[model samples]
Target chain A: MEEKLSVNHLLGIKNINQNDIKLIFKTADNFKTVINRSIKRVPSLRDITVANIFFENSTRTRVSFELAEKRLSADIVNFSSTSSSVSKGETLIDTVNNILAMKVDMVVMRHPAPGAAVFLAKNTNTQVINAGDGTHEHPTQALLDAYSIKEKLGDVKGKKIAIIGDILHSRVAISNILCLKKLGAEVMVCGPATLIPKYIGSMGVKIEYNLQNALKWCDVANMLRIQLERQDIKYFPSLREYTMQYGINLQTLQNLEKEIVIMHPGPINRGVEITSDVADHNQSIILNQVENGVAIRMAVLYLLAMKKTENVKN
Target chain B: MKKRILLDSNHTKIMLRRIAMQISETHGNLDNCAIIGMQPRGIKLAKKLLELLTEITKNKKIEYGELDSTFYRDDFRKGDKFLIPNSLNIDFLIENKIIILVDDVLYTGRSVRSALNSLGDFGRPLKIELVTLVDRKFNRELPIQPDYVGEEVDSRAKDIVEVIWAEENSSPEVWIITDK
Candidate 1:
């Protein structure tokens, strides 16, 4: 028999154990094989229903989640704040309860508030999957990231993965650090001091200010997009100044004189954080991360649904 | 618990040879046929049977593969235990090719049903036949019967049928474990 996750709701990577990560990866391997088949679909979750509630706008996560749900044969109901009753003055719990009344078994939510998904899980009876909740966590993104790394490197232990770019306002970085640390991978956060969080040292990761030094010391560099929309004040002097100090061009990568996998969680600032050539280079796994997103999400949904069914039976 | 031996190593070999001879007699040309085994347990039987089929017929024209249908199982969320899946390793096209589905035991017939559904995703086969070493009569939940059976035995619901192939320091034999 398959082992299920310890926690029912995926609120954050901090709430999960190492066994849960192993279980998710193990299940994703089977799903990776499934998605490669000629008729790519599974009827594992046919009796269940899922609702994707998004308070923030997203293209990749939204499409990836919708595809994952469809391939699992689950009935999907989508909810966006722009077209919902929240505009008039409905509360978050009330909005979720109304959808639960319609019999949605699980909720994949992306909200602006930090603890919105946790709060929803406490108030509702259904399982909650935090797609992204502000700067707190994005569990699924971290999972697919780790899975992509494992797929490329054969293992996550003892491998160096440097998360570059904005660390101050990124939910992906927080989740990634927790996930990679549990999987035994050494992590480093590199960016301007203003963009890096102060308590990052407490998170058990090295902080690098020099892009070239970070590149020389790492095996895989995961460049995150600068959250320009989330920045209300100037984190650095100027975009050009930031690029000159921290941007990774082809020359910068070649200067290291060794092979290092390049990664970017997309909508990248082309010339600021990473050059176009490096992003499209053979070492880049940006597209593989996107492709593995569906399998990873399918694994998350399938495992969580298994727990929900057992709970009902009990 | 009580254990009963049904076939010894010598008898088991004779039974397998008889099954192989029957296949060679029924279908002389295995060029258009694919020998597939169900995952987890059936793989062992399929491998042994394919080796025997090749030796008896002296024909090297048959293709071999392994199939898994854990996703198409009917008792997904309804079962008490979580379902673990094995990797599917069919690297060939079954389009218009005859398929010989192999398994070690024929009880309940649900796994066979699921395997058939899984095979349709590969391609449309000309015909599909089932082969089993042990046919547990009066235990089928579905209307599935083996095209070639090594032996037919009657047993209670809870009795376990075990097939031991000659591998890893053990001789080949068949046993039934029943509780009184």
Candidate 2:
């Protein structure tokens, strides 16, 4: 049997295969041209309306998704968790249903609970795009990260990528691991023993605790932010100890034999996971990742809208 | 399957020269005129025509752009198969200028209509004209006709007319592939 990418709902990176990722990259390539033009707007989604429902705090992801929707000419309605009825004890289903009653064509949601997106997809009548779901997955972020690597290195296959920092609680790390491995990249996770998951070896990834060796062995290093709010119990003794063990500083980067590209899914704790000099270095493609995020998201929303239009026709 | 070769590489060259002369005779000197091609296939014809026009006018400057109509189509997303968009590379302004829209073949005029809608984002033009290599006269669903044509052919609903270029096809030939 042949597997096909179902565009009904973009729940997670696990739901899509490598070909689907390639297709998104191809579409995003076209959109990158659209954005560079003098009139950086298209009427492809003019007939459609989208609702951005963020049940968690975000600055970059929310803004990226909103700009993508606007560039597609889709009418957007922004709903924040602080101002929305979700704070008044309304269930997820009821809040979503009320929003749908106003006639929204799609939903881009960010919730703090894992599997929240899957639950919405199973219950909602509209198309669902997961912005982020707890510590489960941030598929678009992973996609943009992969895209940035492709743009810089010209390919993702046969490249070594080392993910550093809080591996256990970072949704970006899990999604990037799945995405990079699927694209045929050698992936390794390096962090403190407590921060790295116990059963991650079952998922077929090399776990490394020594940051220097990991940096030397990899072509690219993606630094993840340590989520202090998400961590319930103390995973490590102190921040200073963790920084000394795993932090990517200018001195360590200068000691490397080859020039390695650096990446960080931002809201960076500066000196904790990555130093200021390394983050602003010439090899760092962090800003490129942010720019590609809009294109990746535009590709997702456009393709899913096309699928939805096809369904309506039938 | 039955195939009929309408124009070979030599005939294609001659016809392209004739089309260029016809365009030159009408516009005199193409200073404010821009040649825009419908992407995926029209690009080849437009490029050839632009080169010929440049030669005929003794190296006069002319603008050439490619427009992708995938997103502008009215029937977009209505098909069961996935739609892949082509590259759009129009960098020049079209406002108050003569626009020559070029394509390989003019059939139902649906693609031209889509191109018109897509061109709205980049300023409005003073005038727009259609130029095609092959005009399938009886196949037009809309009341549209090309102003400048290289050849006229009669094709059935099941017959496919293909313009093969040296860059893509093994040989440069204009032929019709028919279902026998």
Candidate 3:
């Protein structure tokens, strides 16, 4: 039988074949080689247009995607609610159709509404790449994080990865859990009692309220950024209480194995989810995650584009 | 089992020379052009083409590189695990250079996909044209067509077309062997 690339369109890392995984890694390797060179840009996707439609506020992800698109020689159009017709109370489908009418080849979108990218993909002929959509998923971030982890610690299979912080609200945590689990890693979601979801254990992942116990069992510790903006919902009583009970600090680091790698989906809260020292440590793959983000996005874009072309030809 | 000659070594060399001339004519000159051979038999063909081109144009600056597509292959699951070889020797930058991607045969076009993937690792070229020694019409999975073709042959799925160079097989001939 012909081997099919098993990528989950929604969850992001579902059933991705080993060959396709190797392809992504290999592509990322190529991008890494060109990064330090004089001409960083490649004319691989010359004349191809990519639109970034961000319904949510973001600085890093939006900019990184734009840079990645530029590096691949793709034309980019950045659309946000602040400047676009979205401010004039335009329907998502109408706005998307208008953008699609311009003959853009792909859309890398981030929406406050969950599964917006999936919905757009179902409706539009253009390729829909999920950048981030509410608390549902941020697949590229998860992919980059996985790439970083794989680069640092080799294959993630059989490795213990503890995802810490607010699991209930973190899109990063959801994505990480799905990605890590798919890659055959033992995933553990650990945070405070109120912050951790009740049914999270049903996802075939181990759940722990105590960070100390989770730290002991894990080879990699991924700290999800505590969304301070969502604090009004009262998931936890106080920031101090959350930090003292569930935060990854120096004391927590000292208690754990030295070989354990540190990770964070950034715009870090500094002392809330993870300590400043741990974040700056040698074992931390936070910065590498940022670098890998571009490559992973490139791989996603390339694969999706290739699939589209194949469909059109067929 | 039966074996039949497809194209001899001398015929192969003559075809490559013709291809080189055709390529030279198409690109105006061999001034800013380079030839990259996909490894193993393709490297031998590339070397022969390089010599033929050099004799034709007397331009020693025409670059030549070897490309190993083992690492970049799309169907790694189907490939032999122990057959992977060392990487290619491509010293010069491929940027803005018209690259002629040379291979032994065009069968499934999957190898060409891998070759493209591998080529991207080095540098982006101005234009890429594929040149293959044999064009076997069977089953093509990818949408890739060779710019230069040596010989076109129709074959069944059970038959394997073998191109034996003088360097490897001593008796230089292209043969199709069908095993049942």
Per-model TM-score of chain A alone? 0.98, 0.97, 0.94
Please give the C-alpha DockQ score of model 3.
0.08
Tell me each candidate's TM-score: 0.96, 0.91, 0.72
Best candidate, TM-score-wise? 1
Kindly indicate the candidate among 1 and 2 with the higher TM-score.
1
lDDT of each: 0.90, 0.89, 0.77
Cα lDDT tens digits, model 1, B21-134, are 888888785888889999988988888888888997788767999988888898888878787677778888899998999998899999999999888877799999999989
Which candidate number has the best lDDT? 1
lDDT of 2 by residue, A122-206 (tens): 9889899999999999999999999999999999999999999899998898889899989999999999899899998877788
Every model's DockQ, to 2 decimals? 0.70, 0.50, 0.08
- Relative to the true structure, candidate 2 reaches a TM of 0.91
Clashing residue pairs in candidate 2 (N, C-alpha, C atoms within 3 angstroms): none
Query: For model 3, which pairs clash?
Result: A6-A15
Lowest lDDT 10-mer window, candidate 3 chain A?
A1-10
lDDT value, candidate 2, whole model: 0.89
Q: Tens-digit lDDT track for model 2 on B1-180?
A: 999898888887888889889988998878889999998889988988898899999756798899997777767566675667878887788999899999998988998988887787777898899999889888998888898988898998678999989664222568999987
Candidate structures ordered by lDDT, highest first: 1, 2, 3
Evaluate model 2 with DockQ and give the value.
0.50
Model 2 DockQ class: medium
